[model samples]
Target: MSRLKNLKKLLTVLRVALSLVAACTFSTVSSAALEESISQPPDDYVLVRRVIDARYFTPESVVSRPDAAGTQGSEETWPDIKLRPSLNLKEALQSNIAREITISEQDALSKVVLREYGFGQKNSLQAYAAIEEKIVELNDLGAPENLKAGAVIKIPALPRMALSEPNLLNKYNKIPKGSMYPSLSKVTSFDAFNPVTQAFTEKPVVSGDGRDGSPLVIEHLWLPKDYKDHLGGIELDQSYEEVQAQVISVNMESESLAEDYQSIPFLSAEERMIIKSKLSGQPKLKPVLIVLDDGWPNDEAFYDSRKFVSEALEMIKKRFNYPVALQHPSSQSRVFTDYPKEAFHARSIHKSLATLVELEPSRVWDDQRVRVVYIPLSTAQVYSKAMLEELVVLRLIDDFMLGARGDPVPDKEVKAKRKIARDIVKRLKQDIGVKDLSTDKAIIESALVFADLYAVASGNPYVVNFSWTTRKREHKFTHFDFNQGILVSAAGNSSLNNCKSCRPNLAYSKECECADNAAAEERWFAVRSVSNQDVVAVMNTARDGSLQCRSSIVGSRSVDPLAISFNGYVSDSICGTSFAAPRVAWLFAAKLAYIPPQEFSIYDAPDKGHKLREIVKKSRQGGASGDQYGLDIKKLFEN
Candidate 1:
């Protein structure tokens, strides 16, 4: 009885202690809430995250709290100037005496022209108005009609001014301090170790001895001059400024139309859930893969109807890659076709990107700061072998805007759309090879490019689902620019030229009407023999997820075991080289994450693609061979 009484007393004391502790906890929470309520919130600029390496980001460390709250403060000191945009500042536009000038393909309402005509950054409104008047004068046939080729129009011939201060061109040229990530120049100053050769060099090596590698040979292909002329004719008459203005107009109209579009119009709630599920455990990158597919005609059901293509897009997102979808399935019988209106713009944009990267090799390292767009086979048909080589030497494009596609068709309709696309293409082409890109940095970096050459010909016609056929070889043509970045392409989906189901019997000979009976072996040579150091022609892996002696293309120069999606499922029936190409691109991007931009930039030195190629080659392992010919990527980099 005595012990029980003592236990009860102990319990009473324990209860009182617990209640006191709970009260103190509640009091602390209440005090914090009150302090938070009284304190001013941090400004958005203070909260904005700064990108460290263009690849890595770190949030601002600034903190806001009540004066009485004794929390530790951040050490960073900021400048006193406000970062917000200035509002309602009125400026006047001044124009010099004007002279008559002829408008030609070479003519453009560029910043230089604007400045020469006495317009400055402070005169944007006046500059825009003057350019608009020129466009209106050139387009005699009302809205949507293009400026005729060779039709000379009068323009102001103001005396060229000194590249004046406060000019728009100079302002754009100057990269503001703290605007860009810290320069990679310092990081890349040191040498790299080559594990394969056990030597210290500037960077890794791919093949053919260290920094003394041979020049890469790339096969150039071209469309008949007539075909190119037919497709590219629209550009013959357009100027860069005119087309750019038109593209801007179209985009503005698109934005207006999009205002009424349903949020998540094409994808359903279930589909969104599916996407979420797919993306759940995947690695996210700073850059998004912008899948630029062709859209069908604007029918309510066409975009609204939930379908297989939508799911396929989700699957693509699930492949540890993120996608920014621009268009979906086309109404055409096949997913990819020739001569689509959008194809012209896609091709033009690709050429523009390639040129820009070539001029500023540092652009290759700009992961999302720059973009990688994926276009269909229609775009690939425009490049002939020779034109491709020529593309490397062209002037860099300053800016590009995509031709709008998808629901909510613009009011001006197809004619307006055609005019817009043609003008843009024309502007892009005319602007090429004219600008002086001598000052652009040749910083080497890992770049990604995907060519969806489905049923396309590179001097030889490729049968649908069949990649191999007799191809015209142009071994003599080679380019050094191919080594500037990693160029991933698909080994076409083709088979052997057999008896019953052969394509045209005269594929390699006289005029034959059947599909060619070219085998995988032949296809391998056709695709892989492009002879570019950075080119990696990829073949689809077998259904069992292995790189064996399957019916897929086989060669020393080709890679294997790439997975493709049909309706977004890798196991689905719709499999081809088109799907395989992106996989290799993703692989390259993943490997690039491990390397600093400075490292890739250093390799971009004029020493040839040797440094860049070697870095890629050394990082790769688990191929069919220990030599350059192996296609497997089992253990790309050892931990």
Candidate 2:
């Protein structure tokens, strides 16, 4: 009996072990299947599928819509990689200190320069040796960042200070007063299939004369498709294609915005004294505008249909005499937002910057918060869609899976975006002699562009960035609605669609409705995100009319913006429509006397919505997220 019992127990243990193995195998298969079902652009990159069985994935190419419109104002180089001559720094220091510290024949130490640029101990040793010969007299210096590194600095071959950085990040500081401000500058420098040039082109400037403190008014002149032929009285050359470039810089007809009243909003443009009376203290108007040159000119966005926008600007300018203007877009930013999921990896800031420089502006204002948005000069995928399609015939990656999310990056997405980053580096090295671009190029370029632009217009102080909220897909951009944009969204905890206010089945914001058709939901989410994301920069507008979602309350920063946020209401509550951005704009104009613009692209700013909120808070009546339409204008000048 004992022997029989032992046999039974042993058999039972073996059976249990076998079942476990089967279960594990089943789980492994299931997980792989899920991943494969969603895996996008296939490995055979040569055959791109724009459609799944006759249903288009990417929208068929079309003459895109208009984009230029906004409040605005708004300009690099190549490395001549030659060996630097070595310098006996001690001797060079005897000369003019600042001049001596710059790159001269005496400072070129080939070996040291190569080493500084990271030629490795072996690769460019001889090149360094050759350059070191030129750096004869040395002016070994103290660290501008710190003296502890025991480092020697050399200038580029050019007569000016040219530098290659390879060290821990130096402490960054805000641009000091009386300095230039770099506004949101798009990508400034990068390799491209074709080099960017500013010399004469048939394309006319769409955004014109829209900068802070600029007294000039810009206007566009409607012209025929081949109108470039008549600009200089020479029918030079313009394709007889469907092209519309009618933009010109014009002068403000009235000296003060109040000179043209009755047409604009609050103050009369025809009466300057009216505005002067309102400015009890030191009152000055700094007119500005922002325009994105995404595609074709948007006539509907201007006086024709967007009369309200023009009215608003006029009202503000006339009310306080702050000038404003904006209009543009011909094709860019697509590279930043639209890469395929498998291929979309945020590379170095330098991977796509254009080398187009203009004479630096003479005066840069420092009142309004200015920020910049950079566009890469090259993405390889940008040159042509056909070329990109040919390169990616197989679909291994999904079309809309994401390359980067908000500043608080999700680990899973981060890992995936970087999965092919190493491959990107390898390709760049082979294509243009760069590796680790994600680390090396992108960040560096952003810093440089923002820094330079900031220097030009340091006056605009409190920055609200709209760069990272970018997308590549297509969707409509309806700036305001009955409710939504005006409210602070509560990050609700439920099984609802992330983007949808509630469930999908219900037509709109009827929270109780649920349309759980997985396939339809997937397709709906795949709409092009660019129009949905870029044009309508998300903002904090809850104070005046922004509704607050009960679940997601924003109470992070003390100086958080008291803009607009909604609160839990009954189903019958109709408030804080998704189209409530105007209140933020209106509030901004009202508080212009308090907040100044900075040119740096708010690179260090927390969430833009939060930053905007913080700015309002730091200002006079930015108390809390409640309605305060009767704002006090005096506290602005007091502090």
List per-prediction Cα lDDT, in the order shown.
Answer: 0.27, 0.23
Per-residue accuracy of model 1 over 449-472 as CA lDDT, tens digit each: 111111011111110111112232
* Candidate 2: segments with Cα more than 4 A from true spot: 1-297, 300-553, 557-615, 618-639
List candidate 1 segments past 4 Å from native. Answer: 1-372, 376-484, 497-530, 543-569, 605-608, 619-634, 637-639
Model 1 / residue 47 / CA error / Å = 51
User: 187-304, model 2: which lDDT tens digit per residue?
Assistant: 0111110012211111212111111111111111112222222222211111111111111111100011122222212212432232233333442333222211111112222222
